[model samples]
Target: METREHYFNRINRFGRISFTIFFVLIFTIPTIVCAAYDIFPGLATVLKATLGLFLILTPIAVSEIVSFVPLLGSGASYLTFETGNVSNIKLPCAMNALKLAGVQPASEEGEVLSTISVAVSSIVTTAVIILAALLLAPLAPVFADPAVKTATANVLPALFGALMVSFLAGGDAGSVVIKGQWKAIILPALVVAVVHYLVFPIKGWEGVTILVLLPVTILGARFLYKKGQITVTPKVAKD
Candidate 1:
């Protein structure tokens, strides 16, 4: 008897409440800790310490919500942000689930599957963080080694590289996956190469690598779209 509308309504109602509680907790915890330690400092000092982060993270947060919410739907967005890791774990996990399930993000099945994937990602991330905390003392000496430090420094790069490779390898030529135009691949590759060789060394553009790449991608895609090379075909349901 429950229609998809009713299902989404229920999920949205609960998800809003959950997000509200989490928002309150995040802000409250900072105040609570400051009060307990009597370390409020001055308003200026606090702002000085936090201003850069506030400016940088605010836009990134807004952009991420815009980028991710459509794919995650109502429930999973709340859960994934609360769990705190988005790019590394939550997104890839949800993406893989969608790939396996063969559903478009707007579909009912995609919504449910995305919710489940994010929930599981949250649970696993919590468990891993807890276990790592518990094991930290025992692992300290090993982690203190020079070689270990070097490897730790490279971990993020390696992880991202692997993710990129997986994504590129995922597209079959017949399927024409993910924008599916020569412009999408060749143009971006040239842009990335040029940026790395020429633009990346500029001090002003440092740390906003994604910001640069994103506009280039959109422009490239739009150009292809105008040329009619990029078509809007509905996804075929997998058997």
Candidate 2:
């Protein structure tokens, strides 16, 4: 059997190689397109067009790594980032799997389950995408319906609301319950609310806001933990 250290090392190596290949392939598409059309944009023009988005998304990417990696582990993090639709698909899938499996995030069992769940989620997402593409023309009228649009728009909010309820209420069977976690969340939630209402709209500054709030959330949790307000009690097995 491979040692834990060896397993992690192998995962790191694979992640590095795969990410490099993925990066190359991503640029290769545009490179090929430009070459084929002999229509390469000027460097300055390209930078001007992309610089703002790059700035905005870079911090969000870093924040996702900081926030998600611990919960997802090495293998799943790589797979989730590579496959995209992280918040909408990958994260919820992994979290739901962990909850159902009664595994703590960052634990060995959690790592395996997260990886498998993310992999399966990726496969399913790809299949759905292909199916959608094939059905796009046939489904266009249905998709354009106002009710369908409204339902689609609300899907993400509903999904996250359900996830939050499971975590906050500790209602899921076998899911680990952290006592006083809500107290920690109160401080950050208030801060976010204040910022959203008083300072500026959060929608435009989401990435930057998340990066800033991360430290606040950590400090709040730490303070609560130190005060014995936050306790990680082991789940009681049901008879």
Candidate 3:
């Protein structure tokens, strides 16, 4: 019993420290890098490169942190889902939490903790990340580099495009599938264009595009799902 208590304490401490460090870095690093670039024109290129490197490395860092403790893995996964980025950090974090608790992964208690831990962790992590991002923004001259800002801005649309492509590619290209895919793609674009031109006098065209496309895409996906054209479910077993 004492050993078990000790283990829990250790795990809790680890979780607290890991998340604290993550929040601090997420809040501080980007601003420092951006400010450094602004102060030194020659360093701007290097700073941008560094920022790009950090973006690429962020997933890996999250993965490493989750891998260290399984419960944290689920928390991380929840974070990814909430953040809309699937970088494979969730399950591992959940697994680690279970291990720390001395619970067999197959047990009911283990399963419950895994789910709960991940969900809780995800919520906390997301809030921290968001706060960090907001805090850091004021420190950096992000708007100074129009090109980098534009590229960073495009990341979400690019991710959306990738998601659409993945959905289409995973399914069979039957008549229904093909038609549904095209409709899904075209309809959203059309709605965004029409909305931008007519209904909403939204300031940012991209924001208007997102506002128009989101509902159209959701409705379109449902239409396809109802028609039995695109089965989102996998043919194989889910893990």
Candidate models: Cα lDDT each: 0.74, 0.86, 0.55
- lDDT (10s digit) by residue, model 2, range 20-101: 9999999999999999999999999999999998998788898888888998999999999999988888999999999888
Residues 1-239 of candidate 3 have per-residue lDDT tens digits of 34655655655576567767777988587679868877544567878778977876565555444332342333333343443433233444555565556454434456457767667667766887788688777746655578878887787677556545654443332121233445466667677667767887544344334444566677987887688754543234339
Backbone collisions counted per model: 0, 0, 17
Better model by lDDT, 1 or 2? 2
Model 2 scores a TM of: 0.90
lDDT for 126 in candidate 2 is: 98
Candidate No. with top TM-score: 2
**TM-scores, one per candidate:** 0.74, 0.90, 0.31
Candidate 3 ranges beyond 4 A from true positions: 1-19, 25-167, 172-182, 198-212, 229-239
Query: lDDT tens digits, residues 52-140, model 1?
Result: 98898776777677667877887888888778778777977887787666565757877889999999888888897898799999988
Candidate 2 residue-wise lDDT at 83: 94
Better of 1 and 3 by TM-score: 1
